[model samples]
Target: MPFQAAPPPPAPPQAPPQAAPQGAPFPVPPPQWPGWAAQPPAPSRGAASPYPPPAWRPPRRKSGAGAVIGALMGVLALVFVLIVIVGALVGLSDHDETVSPIAIPTFSPFPSREATTDTRPTRNPTSEPTSRPTTRPTPVLNRTAKNNTLYRAGSLAKPNCRAGNASIYNHTQFKALILKTGTCMGKAWAPALERVGIDWSPPKYMIAARKGRGACGDYPSPGSNVPYYCPSNSTIYASTSAMAREYGPLGSWNGIIVSMMAHEYGHHIQSLSGISDSWWRQTLDSGSRSGKLALSRRHELQATCFGGMFMRSIAASYPIDTTRRNTLLWAYSHLGDPPGGPRDHGNTRSNAAWFRQGYTRPSAYQCNTWAVGSSSVS
Candidate 1:
């Protein structure tokens, strides 16, 4: 009686299983797949199932649309890459087109001397001298005169400047010979200059007996033995005695006289062409003594070239035989600047070479000293 425990209540009574409802579809059993547990017994109607239903699986989606979209995106990416590459190539081409190699500057101040083909109309030498157009074009002055239009003119006409038998020793005969030579020079050069639109007029001639002040300066400044042209007066001044002393044994030769006169006439040509004025301006503006001397050498050498051109033009009529040619070359060799002296004139080699160039080439363009390097003019 001291340790008695109370007893539990009795269990409720169980009801019988119900039958299937009318017109209800029967449930299909799951397939027996490998590695799965066996099917459990079906529960009574209206009763809960013993196991959870299998997990739900959605229907598979079509891959066609996704594949097509991905392919389009890939094509777009490829196009973008190509555009970038093409743009880069085009930019490089543009840069190459704009940039060029740097040109080296020359030391000479004049324009380039590269040979150019002359296409200007040439006058016929056989035509009458007065047949030129009544209207004449004005010559181009300024720095352009250094490389004037005269250079483009055709070869100088031969005036047939025949040398007379008169010896340079006779004053009257020498004067006649010089006058005749000058007349022939005018005939040859006047029409040539006119063709180039330069005014043509004969320079005054004077055979002086003594040194006196003239339009340019005193005649025969110290150590100068040749005839001088005074551009200011457009006259040539030469002394008979000076010529005799300068020429020595060659004084009797008419060829020597003609050459000397021709050289002076060359200066006259320069003056008429405005080259002398342009050259003088450059000389005055030169910064150093050496610079002035260099320009002077070029000027003198150019005159020598002109003299040679005239000589060649008249060679047939003047009958420049072997003896005369040799004498002229020898004279040129001695006409250059003396050693240890002011080098205003070119050296013997340069003077001779330029003269030979003019004789052989016979073109004013060939005598363009300003268009060459200093070494060439030197």
Candidate 2:
């Protein structure tokens, strides 16, 4: 055979390319590397892989010396980082020692008026609510008369009272004077009673032509001619005939009549202030006639003092001159427990002394006859 280059090995047979199946993605060619062999295409879904299985190999063991050296270097780096952090903290602490504290602004939970719209009506600062009163209500009763709150109520306020030349001899004039005096007494006492926590109401008056039955009993009981106060009805019952018989010509003096009325009104005050009730209870519990009489004397003497106190309060307005004052003192001196009588009322001297004390003193404290010695009241 002629020496010709062996014909190139016959080219390997290749399968013909097929058309892509319906709805199948276009095939992607494998990437080529500079010296590596081309890898087969990835298998289609559900097809066997064409690549060989990867071979398993033993894990490489780290060198002990190399691990130790690497660990030491890591520790050194951590130490350096810790040192840097500690130095920064120390520097910050030193700087903070000289720094002043900052004040934080405070905010209220309530909204500011400018930020919120108020729909409510404005309230007047000066106006008080109707539900509350300007003053407290007066009490109905007190504890005792001797050391009573009335003593601390200061002086009695003067009221506009005028005798106006009214003579007690005339029936009409006497009744008018009594009513006017009663009204003035109420006005003068109301504020003082309020101070002592006691409510005050003017007592009703019944000036009868003849003796009649009253709330307590018959008006002119045996041996009693002056007017009497009935706590049960808060009324002053008096018989004009009885008063005329008892006082005689002295009743004509307006000052004398006024003093008598004031003494009776003093009983009304005791009733209203609970002093009469307390005294009655004590009198009943006294058991002995002498003890009861002593208590009675004290009570009656206090009335005289109260009468003087009221007269003093009206001295300026009623214009009680030296003559009227002398008349009052003389009347007080004469009005006392009669000799060989029950001795329920105090002696003439003691009664006059208490009246004088009240007239001279500025407050009810001087009129507390119960606080004095028994001999003084006697």
Point to the candidate with the largest lDDT.
2
Candidate 1: clashing pairs of residues: none
Q: Please give the RMSD to the true structure for each candidate, in Å.
A: 37.1, 34.5
- Per-model C-alpha lDDT, please? 0.70, 0.72
TM accuracy, model 1: 0.61
Q: For residues 1-378, could you state the per-residue lDDT of candidate 2 as single tens digits?
A: 001111111222232234235432221342242244668887789886678778989988889998999999999999999998777656644432211111101122233433223333433323344465466655544458665666666668899887787655566766777888989888877898887677678899988777789888888776788888889999988876777677766745677777778888988878887678878989989989999999998888788877888899899888889988898888878878888988987888988887887677746766776676777888
> Which lDDT tens digits does candidate 1 get at residues 1-378?
011111100122232123224322211342343344777877778897678988999977869999899899999999999998777656644433111111112112221323112223433323333534566456664435456666666568898777779766566776777889989888877888877777789999887654556777766656776688888889998776677677757655677677778878988988888788888999899999999999898788888888888888888999887777777877777778888998987998788877777777777778777777787767
Q: What is the TM-score of each candidate against the true structure?
A: 0.61, 0.65
Distance from true location, Cα of 255 in model 2, Å: 0.6
